[model samples]
Each structure stands twice: as C-alpha cells, then as structure tokens.
Target: MPRAPRTRRSKYRALSSLALLALAAGAVTACSDNDSASDHSASSSAPSSASPGTGKVAKAKLHMVDNGGHRLAFYVTRGSASTIVLDSGGGEYSSQWKDIAPKLHTATGATVITYDRAGLGKSDVVPGPWKVESAVSDLKAGLGQLGVTKDVTLVSHSQAGEIANCLAKDNPEMLSGAVLVDANLPQFFTDEEIPRLVAATQPEVDAAKKDPEKPENRQLISTAEGFAAAHKAFHEVTWPNSVPATVLVSEKTPFAGSPEDAQRWRDAAASFAQEAPNRTLVTAKGTSHEVPTERPDVVLKAIEDMFAAQH
Candidate 1:
C-alpha cells in the first residue's frame, strides 16, 4: 500500500503526542534525582506503629533485585500480615509514593512496599519500548525475592493501573485487593479512543525525540512507541472478580481542559466499576490527575478500608 501524505501523517502524529502529554503532564517535572535523598529521609522519619511500645519510626530497607540483566530497586517498611505494594504513574518511579508509603505503613501496620520500575529512578534502564509483561515480571520477581507471596493490597496510579490489572488477572492469588488512584482504566481504551489518544500524544512524542537523552524523554519515547498497540490489546483485558478493587477518579481528570476527553475519562471509570460487583468507584473531589498528591487523605482512607476489608 502506498504511504499517506507526509502532512497528514505529521498531523496524526501531533495529535497522538498531545494525548500522551495529557497522560504524562507532571511526570516530566519529577524527572530529577533530587527525590532520592529526600525520599530516604521521609521514609525513615515517618512515624510507624509497627514497633509496639517503642514509639520509634520504622526504618525502610532498600533491596536491589535483578531482572534479567538490569537491577530494580525495592523499598520496604517492615510490618505484619498483609503487604501493600505502591506503583507509580507514567514517567515516574518509586519516589512518587515516598510520602504515602510511609503513612500507609504507619496506619495499617501492614508491610508497605514501593519500587522503581525499569528505566526510572534508581533502576537500570533497558533500551527498547516499554512492555507491560516485562513490568509485571519485574514486580513479581521482586515480590518473590522478598517472600511477599500472599495477601497483597496493590495501590496503583495512572499508568501503573495497567500493571495492576495484569497482576490481578494473572496472579490473583497474590493480591487480595487494590486501590486505583486516578488510573488508566482499560475501559477507556476503546477502538475509537485508542486512535484519538495516539493522535493526541504525537506532538509530545515528537518533542521528546528532540531530547532523547533526558530520562523523561526516554520514558515518553518508549511508552509512546507502543501506546497504540498496547492499549488496543489492553482494551480486551478483564479484571478478575475474585480480586476486589476501589477506583478513584479525579474530579478534574487528566484532560480537564478538554471537556469531551474529561467526560470520557469519568465515564470509563464508572463503566469499569459497574462491570463487577466487587469494584467500587469514588470521585476525588477538588483534585486533578495527581490524586495521591492532591488528596492523600482520600487515597489513605481508601487503602485503609480495602486493607481492613481483607482481614
């Protein structure tokens, strides 16, 4: 088949980039190494009730796990019984949950875990497109190494929702429940929607290409490379009814400026929740896509309720 006109192709690409840019709005701003030291201090200083009668904060332990050839960093705060795994959004790493992780640990008395995904934070970058299977494998391997095999409460944000869905479907036995914070729901990736998102994100992808060496750009490139195909397949993903989930949709969604897109986002969340009896949808009032940051109390309460329900 003959290729389309260059102008038309470029137009489509620019649209695709805009969609991805909306999805990854704040991600670029957090692409610095400055969070590393501060994250450590925050985790260490945050009060934890895990230690009975001692009144001392729980120390967070760092573990380097090998995935194929590269290494992924996992941070753990020791607690009892259940384990809560916090996954970050697109173009972000483990430090995205630095504040919430420690607080969750203290509130629930459950072992809280956070980790840097491949090519982000302290994890070794693997050249190539971002793949959800690889992401799921990394998380599973790290959890296995840590002996965290059961009773897991997965707290995922934005892009990590894809990882959480796959984990819940593929390894239902490993997770008891989940809390999705302003996340990307598979319901949003319909045949028509996928093309729109890809087209919208094209401009951002093009800009990232100019500065390929930057950490955020690298992530954007990898993610954009597979966005259309990945989401097309993602549209077919079904969340298992066995694993209960709480879906939190921001009042002003990731595409707040675009009314049509914003309504679609909200509708998708409602659709996902309606699909299963075990799923519950909650709106994060007065917040944007950065729900965890804007309303940590809501995120905390949701996770706490989910954890408590499991027991």
Candidate 2:
C-alpha cells in the first residue's frame, strides 16, 4: 500500500507547533490539571442514570449486562431498521450518546445501542483494575446480550476509541465497520505519552487528593481519566488489522497543541485507512469536544460514508 495522500511535511511541522502551543497554554492554565474547571462526569449508579423519553422516542428499553455481577446500563433504540452502536467519550456514560443515536436512527433507519461503563452513568462501579481487555469484553457481552451480531457498525467517540479498537481486535467478524469521533487512537497510548500526561496532571491530582469531589480535583481527574480510560481493558478488545471507518476530529477545539501542531488528523486517518476496507477522517467544522451531541449531522454523514463504502 502506498503512502499516498498524506499531508505535506510542512503541514506536520505547522500542526506540531500548534500542538506545542496548545500544550503550553494547557500547562500554564492547567488544561487537564485545572481543579477549578468543571468537567461534567456522570455518576456510575442507577439513581443517577439518564431517563429515556416516553413521548416522541421510538420506544427504547433499558438493558442490563451482568459482567460477573458488575452491572452496566445500556439503552436499546429500536428503530424501524438496521443496528448501530454508539460509544461515548471519556468519563462519559452511554447517556451522553442519547441525542446522536436517535438522530442516526431516524435518518439512517438503524437500531443504535448506547450504554454506560461499569462506573459511569447507570453502570455499577467496581474496585478492580479497569484494563483494556476488561472494557472490550464488557462491550462485547453487552452487545451479545442485546443480540447484536456481526452485522453491526460501531460508532465510537473519544476514549471509547480504545474500546472500538479492542472490539475490532477481539471479534473482527462481529463488526461491519466503525465511526470513530475525536478518539485518541493510533496506538492507544505509548509509554512516553502516558507518563507525560500523568505528570502534566500532577497539579490536578494534588488538588483532588485534598477533596475527592472538590471542583479542582474533579477537573484534573476528568482530564487524566479520559486518557486513562482508553487504555483500561474491559474485555480483550484490540485494534483490528482492517476496519472500515471514518475518524471525525474537532475544528472548534484545536488539538491541544501549539500553532505548529499539524492538525493532520485527516492525514493520519487516511494513512490508517490504507488497510481499512474503506476510511475517511473529516473535520467537524466549528464543533466542540462533544461532537455527537454538538454535530450529529457530521457524525451521521461520516457513518453514511462508511456504510456507503462498505456497500
């Protein structure tokens, strides 16, 4: 496979600078380490679970999965047709994908599944080591309990990117394709990357240690947790050798880097697509980190593109 349509070296240089600047701003201002900032992370309990609307909704049901007694909450959207699974971002529960799943179902006529992890949303939080293998297995079991088979396409965002990777790696045949939105992919996290992120978050950790629920502490954990959750294994999910997919990155929130940071998410995705049956990385122009909620149209189109290629 040819290297083909990659961004020019100059572009990478520019984006790289941008990345640095962003990181500097984040560092000085304490991007991920800010305890003062509020990052809305949903609680991992049934009492705090989001409700499914009764009026205009297409009648979805709440399904529970028993991962060796660890219960996870999931919404099953029964559209007039097909099946699609929506995966949320870091520190996010399935509740977050509520808006996007319905739109996808209405527009594309597919059943969509969105759920909370073991500790987020309605899922029961556990005290075990949350690794990548564990996360993938939970996802697979949830899908299995719902009877979602190999004919499904996964729509994953942010930290769930790792989960998507795990699924493709574990059960390649169970997926038709995937929709990756602003996910931290391309190797999960290298050794250098994780420590740097953790070190960068020291201020937040320090703040949080003083008060677990303190606002300052919450912000830092929110930042660090997003990065950490991606690598937390659920059920042996790994990246697949060939996944038909689209990667949607934010244009509003610049990749947390300097002016030199090459915002070549498209270039990277194009490179990844080399092995994918079909792939595209598009810009969600003027969108936030909350892409699925902020720009369902962008996600819908991307998924449509993936299915189009699959067909």
Candidate 3:
C-alpha cells in the first residue's frame, strides 16, 4: 500500500501517541488514599427503578450527582438483585459502554450503571490536576445516593482500573466482584517500568502542552502532570484479597507496537491473577487494547460470570 500523505500520517501518529499516553500515564494522579471527599447529595430527575420481566429493555435514567462542587453524570438502567457499574478508560466517555450496558442488564437482570469521569462527556470538569481519590469519591457518592450501596460488580477499563483498585481496597464491602478489561494493573507500574512508560509518553505530553486548549490535550496534560510520582504511589496499591475479580487482558495489549512493553503488560496481568486465589485472568483472543469494543463477547461473558459468582 502507498504511504499516506504527510498530514494524514502526522495526524495518525498524534492520535496514536495520545492513546498510548492516556493508557499508561493518564491514571498517574496523586492524592492521599484518605483524600477522598465526603459524599455529596445527588439529585435525580427520574426514578432509577425498573421491574424485571416487563418484556422490555430497561430504560436508563440519567442522574447528576454532586461531587464536592461539580457534578458527575451517571446513567442507570434499573433492575433488581445486583448492580453492575461500567467505568470508561482515560480520555474516554461513559458512552464507550453504550452498547454493552443494556445488554448486561438484559442478560443478568442487574441494574447497569455507566458514568463520565470528572472532565469527560457531560460531567462538570474541576480545574486542577486530576486525582484518583476524587474519582473514587465520585463513584462512591453516586452509588450511595442511587441506593446502590452493595452487591456491585465494578467493570473498569484502562485508567479506571486505578479508581477501581482504590475503591475495592477502601470499600470492600460495597463490591461483590470486578471485571477489569485491559486495565492498568499496579504490577505494571514498578520502579523499573514507570520510567520507561514516562519516557515513551513524554513527547506526547509536550505536544499536548502546545495545544492545551483542546479538551483531549488538556486531559493529557492534566493526567500526565504528576505521572512519575503518582505512579510510584500507584505501584504500592493492592487489590483487596476479599473481592473476587476477573481480569481480561487483550491479546494485542495497549503496547502492541512495542514487544518489550507488551510483554510487561501481559506479565503484570498474570502476576496479579497469581497473587490471589479469588482472582482470575482471561485473555481476550484476537483483540486489541480496546477489548470492550473489539471483543464484546469476551467482556460480556466475563462480566456475566462474575455477576453469577456473586450470587
């Protein structure tokens, strides 16, 4: 095939670099584990409840919940018995799970929830550097106000993994299980690996700095501000042993272009699964870093299995 034009190639390269930067460095926000703010009152426009066996797809109700001063938007498809919360990757909106959330509700008869992070999608953006502690507090407060305080199956992708790890560690009783899809595991943020990731993504961070007014660039800059130190703290985070989890690692990991980094990614997933008896690792065969989009069947099956195990 003929090589693309210079502009096209540059655009593609920039996008690819941004994706990689978001994958590795976006979760590296710092705050004390106890830095989470208290839950704020959530105001819902509609009731988030639907009777199972109504012979119709459950309608998703939009709920805007306050997290300190700004609000996070959460969409809930009501069902009885269990709740499944789908968190998107960094630089991504909750709409990433639009096709899967309703299917999960239909297949498992569980209340399905999806939300935009602080700056993504319709959620109000809080100025300053991003903090995983604040992200955890947003989800916790949203669930609490929605009356989904227990029996939750948290399904997280990419950078959301950091939030999930902290949430599970701090509020173990609230979660019954988790399905992590091609997520950022703590094992990959070791002393040896963090510097390599930072070095690789620094160029994109520099590019983002030039056009910081763009939303994507702003997100990249904010998330990468404390990349090195934050990940050092992230490296110390551990998934709670009590919460059962199924980790889905894509066959073509986020670092597919780099064989060395790809191996480290795979090794991290395997190491995590090996550490806890309750943890399970499943490879999403013939898939890319976008596992949820590339292989929805694998993602759905893993989630359904985790949901079943919770009962």
Separate clash counts for every candidate: 18, 46, 0
Local accuracy of candidate 2 as per-residue lDDT tens digits, 179-200: 8887656532434344444555
* Model 2 TM-score, all chains together: 0.69
What TM-score do all the candidates reach, one by one? 0.85, 0.69, 0.87
Please name the candidate that would achieve the greatest lDDT relative to the true structure. 3
Better of 2 and 3 by lDDT: 3
Give me candidate 3's TM-score against the actual structure.
0.87
True lDDT of residue 152, candidate 2: 79
Cα RMSD for predicted model 3: 4.9
How many collisions between residues are there in candidate 3? 0
lDDT of 3: 0.77
lDDT ranking from best candidate downward: 3, 1, 2
TM-score of 1: 0.85
**lDDT for predicted candidate 2 compared with the true structure:** 0.55
Which residue segments of model 1 deviate by more than 4 Å?
Answer: 1-53
Put the candidates in TM-score order, highest first: 3, 1, 2
- The 10-residue segment of model 3 with minimum total lDDT is 16-25
Off by over 4 Å in 2: 1-57, 187-192, 213-238, 252-254, 257-270, 274-277, 308-311
